[model samples]
Target chain A: MGQPLPAPDATDPRRAPDWVRLLEARATAHGARLAYRFLSSRGEVVDTLSFEALAARARAIASVLTAGGAAPGAPVLVVLPSGLDFIAAFFGCLYAGLIAVPVPPPRPHRPDHRMRKVAEDSGARVALTEARLVEQVQAVLPPGADVWTVDALPDAPEAAPRTPGPGAVAFLQYTSGSTSDPKGVAVTHGQLLANQAMLAEAFATGDPTSDGLTSKFRVVGWLPLHHDMGLIGNVLHPLYQGGECTLMAPETFLMRPLRWLEAIDRYRATTSGAPNFAYELCVERIPEAKRAGLDLSSWKVAFNGAEPVRAATLARFAAAFEPHGLPPRAMTPCYGLAEATLLVCAAEAVEVDPAGRVCCGRPPAGATVVVVDPETRRPRPDGEEGELWVHGPAVASGYHRAPDASAHTFGARLSDPDDARVFLRTGDLGYLDRGRVFVTGRLKDLMILGGQNYYPQDVEALTTQAHPGLTSGGAAAFAVDDPAGERAVVVAELHRRNTEDAAAARDAVISAVLEGLGLSLSEVVLIRQGTLPRTTSGKVRRSACREALLRGDLARLDGMTS
Target chain B: MTTPDGTPPEAHRRSSRASSAELRAIVKSRAQVEKFLRLGLAEALGISPDAVDPTRTFTTFGLDSIKAFALTGDLAEWLDRDLPATLFWDHPNIEALTGYVADVLGLAE
Candidate 1:
């Protein structure tokens, strides 16, 4: 920790002028102060970048990106591991006025075609990535894909940062890998700044300009840099505060959850969190002996988001770490989506709802949240179930290149013309109670399993074609929550009077699903053909299939209990 | 508890929930430890036991932190001894994990 940088003005959104100028100001003010501390897997500090050093590196990369004929509004792909290199490339995109499209490098030795889909969907010609991944990514790229390692880019004259207008597109936050139709949420410069400020306020991180740590603003977490929570919360917000962040690879945290807490103690980090499963991981993984040396007293706001927050998880985590000094209220069960640029609402307190509704706090400054009746298109009174709609500065205007989809999702208006403002339909089923948003379940059939979104149709498509016994369109994949975690339960109907051996077919189906979509189906129920419920349009009724499985109504052909 | 060859005597390895006779009857050699892990992980991950790659990392099977913790508890129970949650991370693959678990229990080298 060198001489701390003078705090930037984080109060005003009008002055945000996008994130570029803020970085420039912070770089000058906090020239020697640490901006990012990247930790190695062996509990070692591999790289630490100062604010000034980070800016210089970013500017150098920006110069290269601009010199290579990338347009101001074009999307530049950020395909690097979670490290300082990715941070520089991202800031370089913002510096060069390019929308940085961050995505996980194709799963090693596997064709995770999502990379190509995102690249083509974003129309990104050039990709800023590590040298090691250049060959791997190049093999998947269409002809003439400009793949340049950020380190290889020669240090050139620092390009004048291209600052875009407030409404100008900053980055395309790809919501999911919907393969055929990927969603790139068009987050503008204004929304980015607004969301950062809003998140800071919600997380109770006192000042916008002061990096959260000095005033207890430090965020220590191992969330993937490509994710919304990682990008907006961990990376960008710290930059906005002119503060430093201690970041580790997601694998480091996954491989050892204790390292995440160790960093919190090591850095005296005040803010750090992950999905609910992470808290559970720490609770279940960290034995009593390993917990002896840990001191989580420095952890002030351990806000859990990105997945369903279980009250039991919060209680277990608090009870387990109370001796080590993790406060009860520190485990805040908040909620947000990429559509809202990250923090839509954060609860005021840790009040567990008996109905299993995790309180996703009141809307942040200038943000309005309402639960609208799905069919009526009318606002429902608080304490009633309905589709949640959010209207705010942080809410992105629309999905990139998908006008109809954008109009339906973003331009949501109640039947009452008096409330004319457009709201982004969250598609989450929840009710606002006493000004706090309580998310109950998803309105749509989107299943979030193991922290990743898996639409039933995509899974159904994979499972249905798994075996000859399975009808081409007679399979349904749904999520079933058990003690272990949310798992995919596949209920497929086999062809009637088929001579195929049920055991072999079942194994083939399971293997096919794993190969086709890389998803491990927890239970595969082989029912008699035509046993699966279907809608009038001949589409498989996933909910009915799930209900039938749960209620034990489906007839099993193999006489094996699934 | 050491046998003549230095490995822990198979009969001495104890499990709390179950009687030693049944548990002892199951695992006699080093290969059994690998088989035990393969079956445990395969069932936990919902794949056929044969499909569970001994060389592939646990995360390759889409094992998240939640499932890892659950699997750890199961592993601890089967071993009849308490184990740290980092066992998965330390061992990574089934083949390596089985060797580490066996070494910890002093079952075989």
Candidate 2:
């Protein structure tokens, strides 16, 4: 039953259309086999669930949900700590034929406004949570939302949920927008399966290969489950192939990133990835002197995505771990967004591009990715840079009920008069070089100075490498429209303890920008560490920083001046 | 959100070390606990210490869950007491947190 049934490519019809069908098959075939294992902050396995056990719990939860009479396609918010209960509740909602909306549990330090906005926007009437969080969930929940802990549900499916059709809504994935605003993308069941197959096909993960389909690969990562990268890449992808994932909380990894590698070493895991900062954090945070006897020989597919995939970060990470048995080609750079269901283009076993940019491989089979000049809306030839346009079955139906916003982003067509096809306009700017997508920078963040466009990454990287006094990962470069014209501003953060070096750091930033861009910076405002604002997912919100600069709202260092 | 003292902005405090005696002094009294939380949160958020209102929740003070977890760990070590990860979740604001810390650590006065 576990034999690789069919095609290893994108059209692998064996990649079941519905997840519910797959789950039932997995339970019957791999009943005793472990489906998931959750690790504690100490890196110990705290909970383990088998496919059979998971199916039972999910069915019970489904019964509770169905007995309660939730609407057919209503979104149910699943907010809880990372563990087996979350897994059960998630599949439970799926089994009940209700759209699952997974959100990070409310943290006291973060604003609830975003969660409240999502609840209202998605009109989620039922929230699946724990006893301790009922009060808090109710605080933001609409008057009708019924908060029930996973344990509070009945222990059996009283009424079996009808099997969802191909077009049935699967879930509403909320985009990690500015903290002040939130957006949800409606993903259909068919699209979700399409992405599952695309990822499996692109990465050769869980597919039948020349040696025959061996379900030996296990996913291990601490990427948060709420993010698309985490939900779709780390969790669901593993489940889709009847394989298991060993997961630890994001805080656990951040608190001690070495534990992420150490977990992979201990578990003999083969697949894992996080954003670029995670790889950099391992190198920066984990001193080689202390990482003794570590072995990463089994690791592969160290994906770098979500944020811009930096070539330098990959090189540094590979070099640092090379002694511990990491393959040079294992670091795969991918590019995608929530609008496209977490996978748009990915490298098919690629290496670093010589030009210092990791080549994000071609789009998965049946998906079309084109580079389009935003101004002319015409397709740019190979090796030319432009906004990336993605058209695929995996593309989201639209933003939840936000027609104008959805139409603006989802209904974009190529500039060619003869061709007619809708494309998901990824606001990222990049070029198609050698049939691969090399993401350059954000379209919103592209800085135009003196009739020439400058991507912020070039200037930001220079400012970072320009001086050792400045903190790594703490530079924001954006163009401001001053009275004269468009002028570039660099807001850099000096090392926290070295307050006296702000002056020297500012000079270094200026010199670096001048050297890199051959243009003098209009202003180099050196601030304290963690000053630059980041989105919830940790990408620098340069536009927000630009607005703050224009208004002079920066929390500048005492001696630092623009 | 300017500092009321009209003083220069303070620098980052995460890297420095404090004496055990100094750490004890921070949790000595309820007011001291409140003051400690206010300044600690202000530093974490990269905002003015005066900008942090003791009555405001940590959400208002700008602590994401990760930093909030770090805060609990730090507080547990500083006060030399067992602290729950959900401490901030239960005590939403600094005032409540301070009161709870004082009561639990026997520093209410």
Candidate 3:
């Protein structure tokens, strides 16, 4: 509500550049601004915390973590849901100079594979979780590590040290690892500052403050904080812009899709984001009664990314909520990845062309997105489809402990061989049509049958459309190459009663997938909905599902084979 | 709704009409139903029974149709409940769905 003093110059040694400083800055300026709200089902704020309060708690947490024998730079795996405590733990780690590795919170229905993968990959010396996960984390803790809840940590010290500097490593974000082994992308404070500054510059151009400070913008999000999009896009961006944010647990968003919209209305959130599926969920699930009295005029930036951006999903959401004052341009379908510190190209909140569409507008000032041939490493023509390569300050310092992987994914040249530009090879396959990124699909998820490439999403989409019983957005179509040659198999979850016969369900699923995808599915395993493994962010864990199917350990769909 | 040690008056009356095993099945299915409705039926109804009656109305469990749709669509999948999409309104509650399952396939004890 008031103009704040300017932040000290970049060279000032007192201010550190990591996320720790982000919280500290907020505490210094507008410390009383509401940073979080734990909402009830009715969208009432059940609990609220100010930025200064959160920062102080984080400083306290940093003292406890350091006192608990946590070595600086040691990987501290965080397995917690989105909330005030989650944010505190994340920033506390940054303050203490520890590497934060966020894993999805465990689900009751999922097999132990996710925990196993995280434990193996991170080699975490400590696991910070909630009371609900105490026993589970204890049971799943790797050979050597301590597990503690938020309450278990010691009180904040009255005098905690200042935030870490810009050169400090902030996090080790593990890629989805669908193609190869999961590699941790090391993000530095300087890299984060650069990316967030670019993002703020792009979105905050109309912002009234010439000092690059903002007080009007606010973020409301339900995306999993563990994700790059959630951590940087929704959380850090708001803090960097000197604005506040409201966050809810991912389950809250998934369980009640309309609650997301209600939060925007209640909080008057100016900016928010989610992937394509989230918009699809809102479109399919928001009830007519719940839609009453809803106004989305204040929601300025609604980003769709983390997965391929779908034009139809955006169109449906816009059409359904137009009466509620939901703007078409506010539904921005963007593109980016973990390598780029979460964002690459985002559409400005503006009206789309005549064609019912959502465009991932253009790369921000310090960024460039080029479609390149995966084989030749040459930039393709303007409108051609190829691997999307990104160059920017957001391009993170490569994989932790894996120099070879870092080299392969982060640097490749065009022409002259020796003159190379540091570019992140975003394993995403897409075409540049009119300089806008139209994501086709993931290169790793592509199935090659008879030498023709087929995207799994195409088959999965058709399966959901054909069979009402088949779970939407919960199917996996993957290629299995054996002595019998390569064949595509679609594993779909079916909604049915336990008393229902299995043979009938399997037959129905196979027929539906076959007819929909126009290819005979090598196998159709009718798993119970939610039985399929999923990331903490509610994304269908395709890699885990494929591994389960391959190992004959897909529990609910076991015993019967189609 | 009552404490874990005591049954609610409505639940007590409903349980008298069904056997314990049948009630257990209903309770098991209600877990699925909670996923179906997405709301925590246990918390909403304020009932912590290890089992529930299969023929009672979902309204008795303190849920309305609007919240029921959210649960059925999203929560059901997250909770691993595999009920038909239309079942949210049809079954409505643990007891009603249990009764429906029994009538369809004689699953009642």
Candidate 4:
């Protein structure tokens, strides 16, 4: 039958070398499986798409776009939230052989930095957005480009999604960038498939019949669909494993930390993950009432990743959730990014102490890490804190159209003789204790004050804990360069409502940060609750906060007598 | 319901809608309508319970682009719709947003 489709080779697997064909095959195999779920604008469950149903819709969308004289590999800007429709449209772009460029969904309250960054970087001609918000995205579209909503597409008959050969461009993921300039990582289909395969093996769930782990796992995550973690880790990984998924907006999780655990309990989700901030947020904010009902026993692989994995934060989260039946071993802190198709290294479910600290663990299946000296760019010995580099099938190809950015980030890195592979410069400075990697801070985020290097997170921890009025886990510390250039700035969000007398709280935080880190802060802005800029996934956007401080957008301390 | 922390003592009894509208009007009075429509509406709308239907909302009233963001700063001006930054997630639909605006302005049926 058509040359017996040749025994699945290492180069060309049976799962269509292309993402479009591969997704279709999965949908055909498991049509009724739930693909996505989200909180509607009404704060109620509105949309849920089964794999089979989603595939049929994607096929129709691909047909409509193809009929519009669109060529393969052309960029399609998507500005939708995490929903079944967003998933369908994303896959539809792939099936139609169009490069899906996922931009930050319109938050409608935040800065346009993310949206502008995506549009400017991709140079996308067509933007697919929600029917109600087409004008919002259109206002920012690059000159001469057409923007259309999902409903604008014709209801055409289904056509087989084009299966681009291996090594072809598939999508562009935009990471942190300023409003004027945005950085996008180009991911090829081969890169995506390779990364997923590594994950499948690492998670021990590829073909449970063969991989050992049960295949009945469900992935539940609250990270934004636009982010690499949510798109790849939570969305694609489950689909590849032939599993189900449940998702919600990041705001929902942040507003009510307990909802995260509830989702896992309701779905009996086996795998779920978030950055270190999420765990800390839950421990610090979740009300006592919500904690009484949560049952985290069903969770087998709870991931804590994206940002640096804090030893203290994980310890506290486990202790807090233990009462709710969350097993100590369920916490799995992994490391990954958009450059690595969302997974580079992930800790396994291992035994943890009462303190809630588990090792960052070993490299996932085929993944490897090399800690290198930042200045020398040479590999360093274990237990030494340096720039963490990752190498594996998971590393992305490079930046789109910006070879300089590509070489600066992925191309020019020290190679290891043992691995003989190009490593992704994680830009994260961390040390390995035994085999577990302990991330300290980002290279750009590390503050150099008084000869000793200090991570802002460390300072923030001390500040929040020391200040009685200031809420723990609600403070952000970043370096701001002013006339008195390159000084630390601590911004604390107070628990008590705004007071004419916050000098005591501010002074306490400042004293703690300065005394703990042995450096003085140039300014300390005590803001109301929920003032810091954050990604959709709830990770503090340090860069944005710095930008706000430099531009004088933050409230001034001029009037504070303290 | 939780309220904005910075409200003055005199504003205690007033519904947040009036202050929100006062803030929106102030933001609208100074910024360009196109800019407000592009960025301000999105930012105000993101976490806000206020939602705006582009088709039926601000465009229906003959408010010019300049009136869109006189109170909010430049970030809000870049948005395509003229809703305040708080309207993104909160009042995302047209009727709810208009009701919010009307309540804030103290406009009655």
Candidate number with greatest TM-score: 1
Note the DockQ of each predicted structure.
0.10, 0.06, 0.09, 0.04
lDDT of 2 by residue, A396-453 (tens): 9988878998998899987787788899988888888777888766677756443234
lDDT of 4 by residue, A1-562 (tens): 0011122334332256777777776676666877666653223677788878878877887887787667888999988876777788888888788899887676554345457667877878887787877877887786766665675665666677788766888889875432334567888988888787766655554443432222376888878787787888888888766677888866556444566788888878888887766776677556465487788887877777665565676678788888888877777777677777777766665434344334566675567787889788788898677988888766888888888878878864575446456777878777776666666556877664321245777767877787666666677788764321245777777664545547667666655654343345656787666777778887777778778766766654443323
Give the interface RMSD of candidate 2: 14.2
Q: A377-474, model 1: which lDDT tens digit per residue?
A: 99899889999999989998788788999999999999998877999998899998877899888888887765567777777777767666676788
Candidate 1 is scored at a TM of 0.86
- Please name the candidate that would achieve the greatest lDDT relative to the true structure: 1
Question: Whole-model lDDT for model 1 versus the true structure?
Answer: 0.77
| Candidate 4 chain B: worst-modelled 10 consecutive residues by lDDT | B71-80
Show model 4 residue runs off by greater than 4 Å. Answer: A1-16, A39-44, A109-111, A207-215, A349-358, A413-420, A446-562, B1-109
Q: Which candidate is the best by DockQ?
A: 1
lDDT of each candidate versus the true structure: 0.77, 0.74, 0.66, 0.64
Candidate 1, which CAPRI tier? incorrect
- Candidates sorted by lDDT, best first: 1, 2, 3, 4
lDDT of 4 at A312: 71
lDDT of 3 by residue, A281-302 (tens): 6775665555767999888777
List per-model TM-scores for chain B.
Answer: 0.73, 0.73, 0.38, 0.27
Q: Please identify which of the two predictions, 2 or 3, would achieve the higher TM-score against the true structure.
A: 2
